[model samples]
Structure formats: structure tokens, C-alpha cells
Target chain A: MTQLVRVQSFSVSSDGFGSGEGQSLERPFGSLDPADLHAWAFATASWVGRREPGGSRGLDDYFSRDFSNGIGAEIMGRNKFGPQRGPWQDLSWQGWWGDDPPFHTPVFVLTHHLRPSFSLTDTTFHFLDASPEEALATAKQAANGGDVRIGGGVATVREFLAAGLVDVLHIAVVPITAGRGERLWDSPDELLDRYHLEKVPSVSGVVHHLFWRD
Target chain B: MTQLVRVQSFSVSSDGFGSGEGQSLERPFGSLDPADLHAWAFATASWVGRREPGGSRGLDDYFSRDFSNGIGAEIMGRNKFGPQRGPWQDLSWQGWWGDDPPFHTPVFVLTHHLRPSFSLTDTTFHFLDASPEEALATAKQAANGGDVRIGGGVATVREFLAAGLVDVLHIAVVPITAGRGERLWDSPDELLDRYHLEKVPSVSGVVHHLFWRD
Candidate 1:
């Protein structure tokens, strides 16, 4: 089986902003409310860590559930891991996720300041100061022949995409637009030469755009 | 009936550029190929002045036909009329369209340098050096209570939209991205507060985004 690098269920505003600016603990996705951008995923029945029993079932739910399907390891930016800017001021901050984190596989956090690895539940957080290419090689080995997911916070995804390392990218374009945020691409058309793109709009008002290489 | 300003079958690349820069006679939509941006409309059976007999009959065809329906007048930027900038270098340049233009209604061209009005068949080209509000008033009068159509060249559509004069907008989001061009909006979500938005994806890999104010 060919090992694939995929971005599943990543949400972006209509204007192509993945997250807002000044992302911090109070504002995980910048000034924009996380609920607005992620309501589609959370409303889905298959979303992990759902508070209620019932959620909508169908296309949204199907894609939401696919987030964790084939991923053996995950690679995320430091911003996704926490709000700390430069050096890790506070080691106690495991992540925005509580004690029992979602990912059951090894999750590599890309950062300039590396730290000792730590484990919580089934997920182990490994800090790495490596380029996209270097990080991908490490994650691919840890993936154990399975797929590796490029877990994003915008900048990381853009870097990997610029490096032409991502095999598949599924972006959920929410109806709302982020006036100011971390932009995914100055012009997404820059990738047009390298990838085959498709758009599928769901009844929930979100357009699911898929990009892949043949 | 209430006056409605609608944008029908307007296409844009995934990156949100309606048209590329340096638009000229040979390159209608600037650097971007006209066929690439308008293939969806041309393939439709209802596209006006299609030389060929046969075309696709489906959702695209439906939207293509909707372009002229109920539209009594059109408001467009000077660029949509011709590529000549500053002053009209040639009065012979009627429009990119041949003798029989698609718009049978009075078409208002917004320009700083006004020219005498002329007629071709049932369509009349009226050049006006007026603001968006002033131009719309003239177009509304020519519309004779029928709906007005905002024929775009990106900047014109953005101006009308920003002015909150657009009653409805149907933007066809093509799969390909334009690396550089005139952008419609920095973040389309700014309109979310005023209009109800919806996205409908078609089989042609284009997402039809509809925005309406009640």
C-alpha cells in the first residue's frame, strides 16, 4: 500500500483564511470563533469527543469520521500544539485538548525549540525542530507504512504544500469569511499546476474542496 | 416588483480572482484564458451566439440561460466594455462581442471619460462618468422596474457589493486557481452579516455560490 500524506477536514473561510491572526490561548483560531469555523464538523455524528449523543449524519458526518481513519502518525505546527510564541515558557501546557487527547498515534509538533517527548493516554507528543521535508521523513517512518496526516494551524500546511509534500488535501470551505487571519495561500492557483482539484458543496453550506496528485 | 440587482453565471478561479491583470483585446480576461474561465458557460446549451449546434444540457445550461432572464439593463465597468484605458483610443471598438451583443437591454458602461451613446440592434451602449450610486440610478431607470444586472470585471462587482446595492449574486467557483489577478474580496465573510449565503456544487467541478438578502 502506498503511504499517503493527507489533510482531512481542515476548515477555511470563504476568503481562504485557515485561521484568524493573533492566535493565543483565549483565541485558539485567532480572533475568529472556533465554533463558527468548526460547527460543520462538530455537528457531525462521527466527530470525536462529542458532548451529546445525537449529531447530524450524512456527508459531513462521513468526512468528519474519516479524519482518523488511516493516520498512523500526525504532524502539526507549534501553534496547533499550544499558544506559546517563542520558547516553551510553560511546559505544563500539554495542549488545548484535555488529558485524553484525540490522536491515538504519535503526534509530532514542529517548533524551533525542541523539548523532551511526553505521553498522555495513547498519544505521545514529540517536539521536533526540523524542516517540512525532515519532519515528513520522521513521521513517515513512525507511521509504520500507514498514512501520515498533516495536522495544521495554517502556516504548517502552507509550508508543506509549498514544499510539494502533501499527497491529498481536503479543505472545508465554510460560508463565513475571516476578515483577518492566517491565510492558507496568497493565491491557491499557484498549486494548480501540480494538483488536480475538485469542489463538492454539501447541503450544510460548506464546500468540500479536494486536491490530489495522480 | 422590487428592483433586484443580480450577478448570474459569473465565474472565478478557486483563489477568488475574477479576472487576471493586463486585460487586452486578444486576452479578454487578462493573462487567464477566457476559455478556461468560461468553458462552463460556453458548454451550456443556452449560451447566446454559440456557433455550434450542440452543448451540455444540465445545471450549467440552466444558469447560463438565467443570465438574460428578467434583466432589463446592465451596469458594467469600462474594462468589461473594452481594453483601452485612459481615453477611448478608437471609437470603432464597440465591444469585444460582435455586431449582435448578448445584452438586448441598455448597457451602462462606467468610465471617467464619457462618450456619446450608440445603439446596435436592440442593445444600446451608454457611457457614463458617474459613481456607482449615480450609475445604478440611471440603469434602474433604463430597467423600467425590471431587475438590473451587474456585469462585472471584478472591480465593478466589488464596488457594487461593498456599496450594498447588490440584491443577489451567483458566483461560479471554478476548480482552477488564478495566481494573480483582481480579487473580488479579501474575506467574503464580511457580507455574511447582511446576506444569506449558500453553496451548490455541480458535476462540472464548479461550486455555485449564491448570496441573497431578504
Candidate 2:
């Protein structure tokens, strides 16, 4: 079985900013609110967290539900791991997701400041100081027979994309524009040369742009 | 009846660029190809100059057909009018279009260097050195109770939008990204605070984003 690397349900603003500018401890997505970008998922019946029983069910919901299917290992950037830059000031700060976090499998956090592997719930985050190719190889190995997910923060995804490592991508475009931030692409058409794209619009105001290696 | 100021059937790339960078006699849309940005409209049955009888008829065609409906005057930037800037090197240059232009109404060309009004078929080209508000007022007067259209070249549309002079807009979102050029909005969400938006996707890979002032 082929081990695929996928970007699933990654949300970006219309201008192609996955997150906003000025990312800090308070704002993981920088100047942009994660809620604004991930509203489609949050409103879906299949989302990970639901305080109540009521939520939407449709195409948006299906993508939300399909986010973690056949994903054994995940790879992400250090910025996505936390806001602390340069040699991790606070070792006590585990991650943004506390207690029982998401991601039941092993996760490789690509960072220059390497640290000992830590566990939160079923997700064990291993700090890896390696290139995109190196990280993906490690992730694929950790995945066993399952597929690997290139979880993002903008730069991480860009690195993977630029390296031509990602196999499939499901990019969710929220109508809102962060106006400032790291952009995945100036235009989604930038990937047309390498990837076949299909844009599907959901009634919830989010356009799901699906891309696969051509 | 109220004289509405509308931005009709304006085409933009996925990343929000209406035209490409680097303008010249050869490329009207700067570095971007006008054909790439306007492929959807050109394929429509209502397009101004389609060579063949067979063209797609649906929402995309409807918007193309309604491009000039009830429009009596058009306000455009000098760049949209011609390539010659500063002093108008050649008066005989006329325009990129042949003897007959797409716009049948009186066209107001916003320029720093004003020239005498000239005619090409029914479309009279009147050069005006005026502010966006000033240009709208002149166009409104010329409209003679009919609606005035805000013809674009990025800067002109941005000017009118910034000035809060535009009423209704039917902006076409083509799937391709221009990568470089003049942008309409950093994100469509930026306008949600002022306008109600409805994104309707067509069968022919074009998403029509309709906006009306709130």
C-alpha cells in the first residue's frame, strides 16, 4: 500500500493567507482569528469538539469528518506547536491544545530547537530538526502502513509544497481575508502547473479547493 | 427612479488581482493576460465580440449579457482608456479597441492630462482630470437618469470603492491566480462589514460574487 501525504481541511483566507499576521501566545493564527477561518468546521456536525448536540451536516461537514481518516502520523511546524521562538523559553508550556489534545497518533514537530519527545493524550510530539524531506520520511515511517498528514502553520505547508512532497491537498477557503500574513500562494493558480484543482463551493460560504499531484 | 452606480461584470483572478503587473501597448492587463482573466466572459453568449454562434448560456452568460443593462455612462481610469500616459504622446492612438468599442454609453476617462472628448461609433470618449467623487458626479449627470457603470483598471475601481461611491457589484472570480498585478481586495471578507455578499458558482468554473452596499 502506498503511504500518501495529505493536507486535509486546511483553511485559508481569500487572499491565500492560511493564518493572520502577528502570531503570538494569544493568537496562534497571528492577527487572524482561528475561529473566523475555521468557522466552517466548527459549525459542522462532524467537528472534533461540540459542546452541544446541534451542528451542521453537509459537504462542509463531510470534509470536517474526513479530516482524520487513515492518518497515522502528523507533521507540523514549531510555530504551530507553540509561540515560543528560539530554544523554547518555557519547557512547562506543552502546547496550545491542553490535557487530552487531538491527534491520537505520533506527530513530528519540525523545529530548529530540538527537545525530548513529549506526550499529551495519545499524541506524542517529537521535535525534529530536519528538512522537509527528512521529516516526511520520519513521518511516513512512523505511520506504519497508514497515510501521513502534513499538518500546517503556513511555512510548514509551503515548505512541503515547495519541496513537492505533498500528494493530496484539501484547502478550505473562507470568505474572510486576514489582509496580512504568510500566504500559501499568491494565487491558487500558482499550483496549476503541478496540481490538478477542483473548486467546490459549500452553502456555508466556504469554497473547498481540492488539489492532487498531476 | 434612482440612478445607481454599479460595478458590472468585472473579472478578477483567484488571489484578487483584476489585472497583471507591467502595463504596455502589448499587454493591457499589465503582466497578466487579459484572455486568461477573461476566458469565462469570452466564452459566454453575451460577450461583446464572440466569433462563433455557440456559447455557454447560464449564470455566467447572464452576467455577461447584463453587463451594459440600463447603463448610460462608464467611469474608467486613464490606463483603461489607453497605454499612453503623461501628456498623451499620440492623440491618434484612439484606443486598443477598433472603430467600435464595447461601451455604447459615454465613457469618462480619468486622467491627470485631460483631452478633448472624441467619438468612436456611439461610444464618446471624454477625458477628465477629476477625483473619484467628481468623476461619479459627472458620469451620473451624463447617465441622464440611467445607471452609471464603474469600468475598471484596478486603480479606478479601488478609488470608487474606497470613496464609497459604488452601489451594486457583480465581480467574477476566475479560478486562475494572476500572481502579480493590481489587486481588488486583500480578502473578500474585508467588504463584508459594508456589503452583503452572495457567492454563486457557475457550471463553467466561475464564481460570481455579488455585493450590494449595506
Question: List-wise, what DockQ does each model earn?
Answer: 0.03, 0.01
Q: List the residue pairs that clash in candidate 1.
A: A177-B189
DockQ top scorer: 1
The DockQ-based CAPRI class assigned to model 1 is: incorrect
Residues A1-214 of candidate 2 have per-residue lDDT tens digits of 4577989889999989998888898988888988899999998755876656656534565477566766889999988888888888778889987777678889999988988899988889899999999998898999988889999988999999899999778899899987788888788999989886767788888988877663
- Residue pairs whose backbone atoms clash in candidate 2: A21-A31, B21-B31
Candidate 1 — which residues are off by over 4 angstroms?
B1-214
Interface C-alpha root-mean-square deviation of candidate 1: 12.0
TM-scores of the models, in the given order? 0.51, 0.51
Per-residue lDDT of model 1, residues B1-214, tens digit only? 4677988789899888899988888888987887898888887655876876566544565467567766899999999998888988889779886799999999999999988999999999999999889999999999988889999989999899888899878888888888898988655566789876666677888877777766
